[model samples]
Target chain A: MTGTLFLQTLVDGLILGGIFSLSAVGFSLIFGVLGVVNLSHGIFVLLGAYLGLALKEAWGIDPLMAIPLVFGALFVLGGLVQITLVSGAVRRGSLMSSLLITFGVSLMLRDLIILVFGPDVQSLSSSWLFDTFRIGGVIVDGARASGLIASLLSLGLLSYVLYRSKVGRAMRATAQQDFAAGLCGIDVKKIYAMTFGVSAGFAGVSGIIVGLINPFTPFDDTHWTLNAFVTVVLGGVGSPVGALLGGLMLGGISTFSSQYVGSLYPNVFIFGALLLMLIVRPNGLLGNAYKGSV
Target chain B: MNKQISRRTALGLLGATMTSATALRAMPARAATDGVIRFGGSLGMSGRYAETGLNIRHGYETAIKYINEEKGGVQIAGKTYSLELGIVDDASDPARATTLIQRQVDEGVDFFLGSYGSNVVLPCAGITEAAGKVTVQVGGSADQIFTQGYENIFGFFPRASRAWVTSIEFFKSIEPKPKTVSVMATNSAFSKLNAQAAAAGCKEIGLEVLDVLELPEQVTDSSSALATLRARTPDILITTTVDQNSLVIARQMIATETNVPLLYQFLGPQLPAYRESLGAKADGVVMQLPWDESLEFTDPTFGDTQSYIDYYNATNDRPFSYHTVGASSCITTYIEAMKAAGSVDPLAVRDALDAIDIVTAFGPVNFTEDGDGDPILMGAKIGQVQGGEIKVVYPENLRTAETLYPTPTWAEKG
Candidate 1:
């Protein structure tokens, strides 16, 4: 490939990685805090997009402007679901039950969205953001650039919360050892609910970005959920930084394979890489080796 | 004396009631011969293919409504029988389609109207063929469906392989005559065949095939694909995928500013929803379709092409797509076959379908030995989105507008 083409592909891959990283971090947070895989995480993203679309169409609010509303709404919804349905599974400490319950929740949410939206593809349009600009012989999409910036800001804020806040310390302590943290005066159940809320807020932000970048349908969740799972596993299962690295790696591999090898074989390359990663380092690049949490 | 007579009478009455219940259980078998011609099929009403499935359902319903109200039903074997359509939502799952087809067969539906997508139709075809039922379909055009040697399934549209022939032919007719082409399609069987056909046809017409890409079905982004194409920079770009995939590709093309002289998408660009989604970006994109509202044709059931359009617009939320027209044609073709055979029997209708030749609101309907519609009679026509309207630009006689050669670049348009 020529230098310009290679650069263009790299730019595209990184843009895709930014979105994937946001989604993976959300998924990773839930798993890290609750020790329960949130299979419905992708649906939270889709639901957020739909809400953004609704806000845009009904109230003339731009998708970017409506992001905060989407995030808050999803956070509340996620918190309610955790309190009402998921707490029982977590209390019982049955991982399979948690997986199955969340899977069921995902299915129900997908069906509900389909009922409301009628399975037609919906897109978020920003006239100015959809244009393209050239940067040193490489084409860059305005929407993707904005999405990348938004992803970084969200990730930075999440890191600040995790590392610099009192609640963040309590959440970490509970994740490490709920019993010990409870004895130390942390409200473990409340921390779980808060973690789920924050995790879903991340998904909400990612969803708006995704909708701005691509047209989405109700069925898009499963595809994204699978990609997030792959990203989490490839990165350290419960590590946000690892998820970011894994997302970038996957995006680069998908883009390069589609460009050089064949578009048809990108999935093959992705899964193959996943297999190799699992075999070589099951705990992932940054995962806790002894914990084997994932 | 009254009490003694009641004991024997009660025993006789109980035996008579038991006999009546047994007779009532056998009533459904007789209902099949009750002079009502029932058509049954499954539609993808709830999943990825739901929009297209809804269009097909509306088309079939419109045609059936026209037949019953305007044409006064079909006269078979010296008696007039009204048409009844029994539809079930398969939720776009092939397994559900098979199960629904078997249920319809058991319920004694006289024939089947095929559902949308080749994946669903192929499995439904197998079930219908095994049950000795005849199915008239417009959704599936995969070559595999024809090669199965099943005489029961009849297609109303041209094969998937020839779906893009008219678009290629239109390109050849342009003044500059585009020479290089890049083709991409979703990796599904139907889409793959569509892309392969476009590539092969372009080669046959002396255009250099720059690239042929098969993207995964679940791909939500196309930036990398567009970036790859930017290096090659073909004169023409062709996409053979569903509406959503096509829309994504089109938007990404605009975002990346990858401009070509001509762009043709197999199915998406023809629909009103697609145009609405992309707005101005939808302009200058050419499409190939079997039928459009502009076509001038008269049908016995629905007065004429214009009338059909009026009816569809009046009833449905969106304008009639090619899928709607193709689906309506399937029902009309079956009605014509029944008229020719003078019977509602599945075997007789299947034979008559092979023998009958007629034109409907969509186009001419003639099934070849392989049970596929003859491309010569029902070939695809090229349409281009110009000034926010889809206009027929090819086939000379049916041309509503002249072909706009060398579509303007995104920057130029802006």
Candidate 2:
């Protein structure tokens, strides 16, 4: 391939990677802090997109302006679900139970979205976002560039909240040892709810970006969830920076294969790479060695 | 009587009386001549195919309502029988669709309506055929359904194997005369067959087949695919996939600015939701339409095309598409067959369906021996989105608007 084409592919991959990284970060955060595999994470992403779309349609608010409202709505919903249903599963101390609970929640959310949206594909339209710009003979989509920027900003904010805040310290402590942290005067329950809320909030932001970038349907949740799961596992289950790296790797490989190898079998190359990663380093590039946490 | 009779004699007397009463009760409550003709089927009401499923259901419902309320039910054997339709939600799963068909069969439905999409319809066809019931449906255009030699299953839509022939012919007629084509399809039964046909059809017409990409059905992103298209830069890009996949491909093509002169998709571009979602981006995209509101055809049972559209639009919250028209035409076909055969017997109706030839809102309704609509006699029209409205642009007689040749690139479009 020509240098320009290669560079164009790389640029596209990076933009796509930004969205993938944001999607994975939320799933990773919940797994890290709550030790729960939130199966409904993808639905939360979709819900976020739909909420943004709804707000735009109902009140003529710009999608960018509706992000905070989407985030706030999802945060409250995540907190409530964590407290009401997920908490019991977590308290039971069975990873399987938590997985099943989240799976059920995912199914319910999927059906509810279908009920409301009627399973047809919907997209967010911004006139400015549809414009294209050129850089050194490589074309770049305005919406995707914006998505990349939003994804980076959201990830940066999440990193700050996780590393530099008192709540972050308490949340980390709770993740390491919930009972010990509770005894040490950390409100473990509140930390758990906060972690879910933050994870879902991240998902909300990712959703808006995704909706702006591509058309989505209620059935798209499973595919998005699978993509996010692959990203998180490849990057390391608990590391945001690792997720970014993993996302970039996945995006690059996928785009490169489709452009050069063949469009039909890109997934074969992508999952093959993930399989190789798993065999060589099961804990992922940045993840610590696995230990039985639950 | 109690004092005089022995226990055995009294028991025998009561048994005889009860047996007679039971026999009388077991007889038909209403005369056989006054019975209702029940048509049963399942639809994908709550899954990936829900959009098409709902449209099919609405079509059948509207047809049945029209027959009952307007035509005063289907006349059979010198008697008017009220048409009763029993539909179940299959949730877009073939196995569930089969189970629902079985349940409907067990309920003793006289006939069956086919489900939406080829995957669901194929299995449901097996059940209906095994039960010896006549099934007429507008969905499931895959060639396999016809190749199976299922005498009981009749499809109203043109075969998937021939679905793209009209589109290719239209492409050939363009002023610029496109030379190369790229075909992409989701890796599903119906889509694969359609894409294969499209490629073959293009090749037969002396156009170079640039590439054929068989993508997985669960693909949520099409950026990589668009990247490939941008590189190949075929004159025309054709995507034969389900609604969601096609929508994603259309959006990504625009987002990545893959500049093909002409774009066509299987089912997505034809949908009202496509225009609503993509706005001006949906313009210039071409598709094969089984029915459009502009058609001036009329069925004896459903009156004119406009009448069906009016009734359908008045009853349904969403605007009706060709799927609705096709499905309603299936019901119209059944009504015509029953009226011709003068019997509600499945075998008779199946025979009548095989022999009956008529035009409806969708188009001509004539079935070949394989139970597919005869392509030469009845088929889809090629349509393009002109000014946000789907206008029939092929078959000179039905052309509502002229073809906008060499569609503008994303950058060029207003």
Give DockQ for candidates 1 onward, in order: 0.64, 0.52
Candidate 1 residue-wise lDDT, B1-414, digit = tens:
898789889988998999988888645433433366788999998788988888888888888777766666667777777777888899999999999899888888869999988999999999899889999998888888888899899887667775566766787898787879999888888788888888998899999999887788866777767877777889889898888899888888888898888888887887776887778877789888678787888876677888888887876775567778888888888888988988878899999999978878887888889898887777888889988999899988889998887899866765
Interface RMSD of each: 1.3, 1.8
TM-score of chain B of each: 0.89, 0.90
Number of the top TM-score candidate: 2
* C-alpha positional error of residue B98 in candidate 2 after TM-score superposition, expressed in Å: 1.4
Compose the digit string of candidate 2's lDDT tens values, residues B25-65: 64433233366888899988877788888888888888888
Ten contiguous residues with the weakest lDDT in model 1 chain A: A285-294
Question: For residues A115-162, what per-residue lDDT tens digits would candidate 1 score against the true structure?
Answer: 887787788887675677889988888888888888888888887788
Cα-based lDDT at residue A35, candidate 2: 80
At residue B105, candidate 1 shows an lDDT of 88
Highest DockQ against the true fold, candidate: 1
lDDT for A136 in candidate 1 is 94
